[model samples]
Target: MDDILKLVEEYIKEKDSKKTWVAGEDWVQYAGPYFTHEEYVRAVKTLLNGWLVLGAEANKFETKFPPLLGKELGLFVNSGSSANLLMLLALTSKRGRNLPKGTKVITPVAGFPTTINPIFQIGFEPVFVDIELDTLNLDLDAVEKACQEHPDAKVITFAHVLGNPPNMDRLMEIVKKYDLILLEDCCDALGSTYDGKKLGSFGEMASCSFYPAHHITTGEGGFVAVKDEQTERIVRSFREWGRGCYCIGKQNLLEKGSCGTRFNCWIPSLPDHVFDHKYVYEEIGYNMKPIELQASLGLVQMEKLEEIGLKRRENYRSLFKAFSKYPEFFHLHTAQPKSDPDWFAFPVTIKDGAPFKRSDICQFFESKMIQTRPYFAGNIMLQPAYEGLHDKDEVISKFPIAHKVTTDTFFLGTSPVINKEKTDYIEYILDCFVAAIRI
Candidate 1:
């Protein structure tokens, strides 16, 4: 086994080193995973161990990943979407905050569907609001306005746009003033920080992704982060089939149990309505746990978190500089003050009256073998699935910035893959577009 593992490690190094970029031949993806030989080795070792469920590897990951976000505990789930649902659902748990049904969750109009979908799924009332054009984050001014208009709103949920959070100082002030719960979606802002604290730390509950396109990759995984153990257990209950049992990893499989009182939640003779902890249903939840294999892969990915964040920021600056050269044609992303963003992708909005259309520049990028993505699910109200979701006919017109984003905003690769070579290539592409528009 040792000899075979050594061979595997050497092969991974050889294969990984061979990857390279070509000016017009390789498609530079907007985001992707960066894995090393350590990841490969750990994955293989875990596979060999044959304990394939969420056990030791998952346990290690929960402990290791959250501290960077200033959290002491977390619950691993199948995806970032599930992480959102887990945390939001956990808020209703008797053991947790125990907020009432129909709690109002204020969110940005422009964001991925999963963030909003969970609100409806959990029967929470969603109040959609606009985002800042420059930051593509929820407009806190609009949020304060929403709070004034809908004073009953109890929670605020929104993504840190492309890993750049809105002004945290102002956001916290709004949270405090309105007495609202912050359910932040840190899916894009894994290593980002506001006021020297991680993006996920300020919120009551936060969700993070581990998709290949995210800062880390576990094939398909995410986690719900929390500041306290009780919230952790509440979220854990939702993730683990809503069981009351809090046992993690090998503890579940222990012969007498970690508590040394196996199956003691119930006594059959006593009519006291007792039941085994594992069989006790707590919350109405779906199965959303990720496997041990995914956790093993994530463990290795966290080792490169700091370095990955540095490269992403460097790439974002280069991209921002390149686009800033065409200020008349673009509205480049402006990050929040006192915040450090390890940008997921550098988003840009085509100026409303720019000479060239978004399609024009998108075509140029495609020709150069550069990949681009539309800002995620902009104006989700316009989507077919949510046709009847909103009752107000004026809802679509209320958030003009989100509508503009749907038509005008796009993003380019800011992953570590966008090195000096990619930056130069992108500048050349932009220059060609500018020249064409001038002609």
Candidate 2:
């Protein structure tokens, strides 16, 4: 073990060392893991311990992550997409609000597909809303109008776009006024806040990602943070293959599992017959649990969030300043009122009548080997997968902002990986693009 540890240390020192980028040869990714020797070691150590399943490491992450979101409980899952689907499942499942198939869910169209896909997958009708042009968040006025128009809508699900939140105060008022269950996709806004409250806390349930592109990385994982224990249990049942037993981690099964009656449980339908609780299936569920190795990586990643958040904010400001000089060409976003975003990117929109279109600047970045991304699935309603399924009139007349984003909006990375050297390089790339346009 000592010999192996010595070799591992050497490997981490060499491989996890600070990276250097060449202007032309290297690609400046829009997002990358801000990892270090510590995360590597923990991942290695987890494997060395032969603890491959969800045990102490997963339990630790579940305990540690929720408070950061101001959530009372959490369910660590396999991926951000799964986390989101579980949030939907927990709220709409038979043991939950249990709304029937074809229930109405109010959601935005200007978000990643996961946020919208689950609504359809779970058999809910989505009422599309346009995003605020600047912040790219769901327009609250429209959301209010949506609530008024669709009073029967039982749930409102939306993402915090590029870590930017809408006006939470007004949003909550709408949530209450309409009695809608709130499900926030905080996959991008891990460290953001509004009115001094964390972004994830404002909703009954929220999801966070730990993918390489997000604020933290656990190879591939995410979390579902719930408002209360009962909500957590429901999500857990859905997450852990719908098992009735709640025992997770190794210690819980040290005896008769966490419930102390693992083998003495009566079947729900056959109360006269008893069986092991661990094998008792409940609701229809999927296996979305994260492994102990990823959880180990997450434990270290959580410790670096404060640092990651600071760099993200710093890079966002720098990019904003760079773009400000070319105001005629770019339309920049303003963080919504009372929002202090741990921003995910520096979003830009090509203003109407601008000399260059979205593709022009995005292509310029690509040529320079600097990363850029078009806004997430722009006007998702127009995506081929959603063809003929949505209201064409809604896309044409009701969602003007959503319509523009599909053509004009794009974004750049604001992750901590954009160090001073990279930020300067990005600025140079932007200046070159603008200079060419001017000529």
Candidate 3:
């Protein structure tokens, strides 16, 4: 078996020797595929070991991840969206201090749907708010107005859109004043900082993604970080099929059962004590855990997060400088004061009356084999998924800012893999766009 594995590794290494750049590429991509041979080898070894489920490696990641973000507990899940689901479900658990039912959760309309979907799924009302164009994040003024209009709001769920941290100081003040829970969606802003603190650490709870496009790539994994013991317990319970037991994975070796007797358990007379802890259920939950293979990849990815963040920031700066010269054709998004963005993507908005439409420019990039993506779910409320989910008249016309961003905005890649060659090609394409607009 070892010899066979060695041969497979050798073949992979030989294949990787040939770097294939797509031809006729006039511009770069919105995200680059990031991976190293060593990481893949680690994943394969984990797979071969037969411990494919969450175990020691997952536990190590959970332990190390929170400290890096200045948090207490970290729970890994299958994806960032799953992490959000786990956090929301945990907040609603019967064994936990459930947030008020029908509680309104304030959120920006221009973000990923999972951020808001979990609220609705848990029977909480989501109050859509507008975002600031400068940071592409929830506008503090809009959030304040929403709170004023809906004093029943008990939670404020927002994202650091495109890696630009929101006005955390102002947002936290509102959270405290209104006695609201804050859940920061840091999936896109893993390494971002505001006022010297990490983006995900400021909120009561935070969520992060480890997809390839994010600052770090774990293929398909994510985590939720919580500040307090109670929240951590709740998070773990929800992630572990809502089990009441607080013990770690397969480590509850204590012979003294719940009733102080090895054979006598206390829950409605069960053969004097033959109860299996595996069958226990404390809260309504679902299976949302990731495999050990994913966690193995995450361990390797975490080691490079700092380097990846630096490259993303550098790429963002270069893109901004290149586009700053064409203010008439492009409006560049800016970071908030006291923010050092770990930008996920550099957003660009087409000014009103621009000679060409956004679709036209995007197609040009596509023709050149350059990839692009619209700002996440762009005005999520406007999407078909929300047609029957929300009150059309009340929300459809209210989020003007979100509407503007959804229509006029698009973002480019700042992935660490992008280099000078890619950036120069992108600039050249933009020059063509400028010339075409004048014609």
Candidate 4:
């Protein structure tokens, strides 16, 4: 056992050492997983234990993660996309007043597909809102207008775009005025806060991603953080195949269930015989639970968040400073007045009258092997998948900002992997591109 442990330690060191960004050869990766030996070891240890499904690691991660973002509880899922779906589905469950079918949900059109997809998937209509070019978040006035125009709007779901938080002060006021439910997609906003409070904590429930590009990595894992136990149960119900049993972690058959009703319950809907609560299906659910290995890695990833988050912030600032002088050509990102963001990336948009086009600059970055990505499905409503589904009135593409994003916006990496050296290189290349275009 001692020799085996030594081998694992050695394997981690050798692999971790090779992960550095090697300037010219390696692409200044748009984003990559920030992980180390600790995460690797934990993942390996969990896999070796052979408890492949949800178990101790998942339990610890779920419990430990929520507090960092001020959430009281969390539910782990296979991916952030799945987390979004489950979060919305949970709201439409009993805990969320079982929002009636065809209820209107106000959300931005300029966001990841899953953030808006789940609304439609759960049979709710999304009243599209335009995003602000500066913050790349929902336009608050448009949101209020949508709410007043459509008095039936019961839910507001949106992401903290590229880690830039919206005006939460006014957002919450609107929420209160309308008695609307809030679901934050914090996939890009982990470690970010508005008015000193964490982004995820402000909403009824928030979803986070641990995909390679996010603030942290658990390979392909995500979690839904809830404000209370009832919401947590609703999220878990959807994640754990609609089962009503609440026993988390590794369960021992000999031990009584967490609720102490494992075998003692009588289901009114079931035939007159007593049934184990574990086998009972409460809501139609899917198998969205993540494996224990990912959860084990997530525990280690959570610890490195602070250090990694600092680098991301630094990278964003450096990029912003570099581009500030070129505002006419580029409209760089801005955070809400009260937001102190732990940014996901350094987003930049080519101004309408820029000498060159968005493609021109992005191609230049690609040629240099420094990766750039278009803002996640800019104007997602225009994407092929959403083509015929949205009616002319259902989506508000009339506001040109979202459509402009589709043509003008793109982002560069601000992940921990982007250090001073890479950021300098990015600036140097941007300078060259602009210089070339000027001639």
Against the true structure, whose TM-score is highest?
A: 2
lDDT of 4 at 228: 80
Model 4, runs deviating above 4 Å: 18-22, 391-397
Candidate 2 lDDT over residue span 293-317, tens digit each:
9998999999999999999999999
Task: Give candidate 1's TM-score.
Answer: 0.96
Please write out the lDDT profile of model 3 over residues 256-298, one tens digit for every residue: 5332443424345455656555566667767788889888888
lDDT tens string, model 1, 344-426?
99899999888777888998898889998899889888888888767545666788899889999998988886788888898
- Point out where model 1 deviates above 4 Å: 259-261, 265-274, 391-393
List model 4 lDDT by residue over 327-402, tens digit each: 7898988888989899999899988877788888899899998999999898888788888976644554475899
Model 4 lDDT at residue 335: 84
Worst 10 residues of 2 by lDDT: 15-24
Model 2: lDDT of residue 407? 89
How many angstroms is residue 50 displaced in model 1 relative to the true structure, after the best TM-score fit?
0.8
Question: Where does candidate 2 clash, by residue pair?
Answer: none
Question: Could you tell which candidate, 1 or 2, scores higher by TM-score?
Answer: 2
Note the residue pairs that clash in candidate 4.
Answer: none
Worst 10 residues of 1 by lDDT: 262-271
